[model samples]
Target: MTPRIHGGTDALGPARWDFSSNANACGPCPLALQAVQQADATRYPDPSYTRLRAALADLHGVEAARVLPAASASEAIQRLTAWRARAGDRRVWTPPHAYGDYAHAASAWGLERVAGPALAQLVWLCDPGSPLGQGESGAAVQAALEGDARTGVLDCAYAPLRLRGASALDPAQRDCVWQLWSPNKALGLTGVRAAYAIAPRGSEAAVAALQALAPSWPIGAHGQALLLAWAQPAVQDWVAASRTTLAAWAQDLRALLARHGWACAPSDTAFGCARPPRPLDATALRARGVKLRDATSFGLQGWWRLSAQQPPALAALDEALQEQEREAVR
Candidate 1:
């Protein structure tokens, strides 16, 4: 969970950006490159995300009708969660430190925002948390869903790194909704603008009921093809490489922070969490030119979420942390 700064004007391009949850800090998937070249500019794409939906359906072992593709996981989760909220479910509870988008979506529906175990109609959680990059069990997730008409949204935004994902929702729970993987993180297609949802099959009416509520078809032709390629077995192998690189970087970040006496939360994946109110830490670090997210804005208890998006960031972290400590004396 990173603080959402209003205008990242000063932090714009020119410098390589590292604070991201996407797979390749570099760019879109190679598979996506092929899709972009192959797109037929002469005609409109399948308005339904049909080919792409079928591909994603096969990946999840579900029928195509049960899936819905969107602009991003942010939009996909918003639509699904908002639909449930509209259907008489009032509250949407999420963890304290969240991706910022979930809370934004919940707020859109006029749902009362309460986070973490307070008993709400809907609970949105990133199983492998965004800040800590740690995942929770499907069984524990299911038990939480049992308490309310709440449809638990397991945001599998970083499932690839943890090797775990959204299998918590079954065919039964009338209140379960799953926010599947955000391709930006798992497949390196951040600009491809693709994400899909896995709803229980046979919920055609429920699905259609949702469809009718939407104003228009999501995902253009080019975006659809990009998602389909990313879902391929061959391309997922390349995604595996990115995960390996991220894991190594995560370890390095933890070590670098420890040298500065920063107690980062033990993480299972790339993003490491830590406290002692890092807002000032980030401000101080930036003064000497090392940019990172300050966790203060997340409303969590004084923690920061650092991204392991680049190898060069390893050296950057060391210099920044050291500078932060020195500035403290002044």
Candidate 2:
């Protein structure tokens, strides 16, 4: 079994200067947060999620029947993988560097990892992809959608957080593939585990299969509240404004790392991968309450994926690095 490698809070709890997660630094959106807090936890959410589905569909301008709720993006990956596997899918293709769950779920469901999209039954695509914070190539996107029988899942987790570059798949093309969305990261409320997918226009049978596999009331009250708030105009405005702040901070992060001789790669989003002048002492940084995501798990060994943080957190990172340098000299 492949171990799941992730960012954000862990066994030791969250780091004070946590650049490990790509969540919106300017969030949690006040409206969204208020909604989540006010959720009616005492009672169960509507089992059918009729209103939630309608609201999300309205936001994306899709039919309610095409909206499939998920417990989280990871859960959706597993469920989708299982759906493909049960349908006799034997081969899967994922981005060279992507969220670990894509491969992890594939492995769990006995799907073989293929080298290319042309040879796979299920294909995973992420725009402003994780770790690298890069978009998929046009060729890859076209290939993933080529086969009528193939299952293509486009992870839109980072779409809302994208500071630059448009998605590889346009609106029309998106309707041909499953578009998975997890708004928690965009709202700066990563603690909420709720996501949904816009099923391909003609995937009624596939959506039914995925839904049947899901447990009743997959999304709890708090998650329902988050999703409802996500569709609001005010919440969308907050997310849009956050991008400006994140873009400036991203520049500060790049300059800070560059000054220390670290080579930073350009990313379309607020986070990017960078290789330090020397090997990083992750434990030392942790002790200083500074945490960064190791890119090794994402296949970029020797590099770290750091998200743009506020000024104070960035300063904490700088001080921690300088302290490490001083200790190395001693």
lDDT winner: 2
Question: Taking the tens digit of each residue's C-alpha lDDT, what string does model 1 give over 58-104?
Answer: 98777888886667787776787678877988777777666777777
Task: Provide the TM-score for each candidate, comma-separated.
Answer: 0.83, 0.99
Most TM-score-accurate candidate = 2
- Candidate 1 stretches with Cα past 4 Å from truth are 1-11, 14-17, 20-23, 26-28, 115-118, 137-140, 163-176, 276-284, 287-289
Candidate 2 backbone clash number: 0
* CA RMSD, predictions in order: 3.8, 0.8
Write one digit per residue (lDDT tens) for candidate 2, span 35-88. Answer: 999999999999999999999999999999999999999999999999889989
The 0-to-1 C-alpha lDDT of every candidate, in the order given, reads 0.65, 0.94
lDDT of 2: 0.94
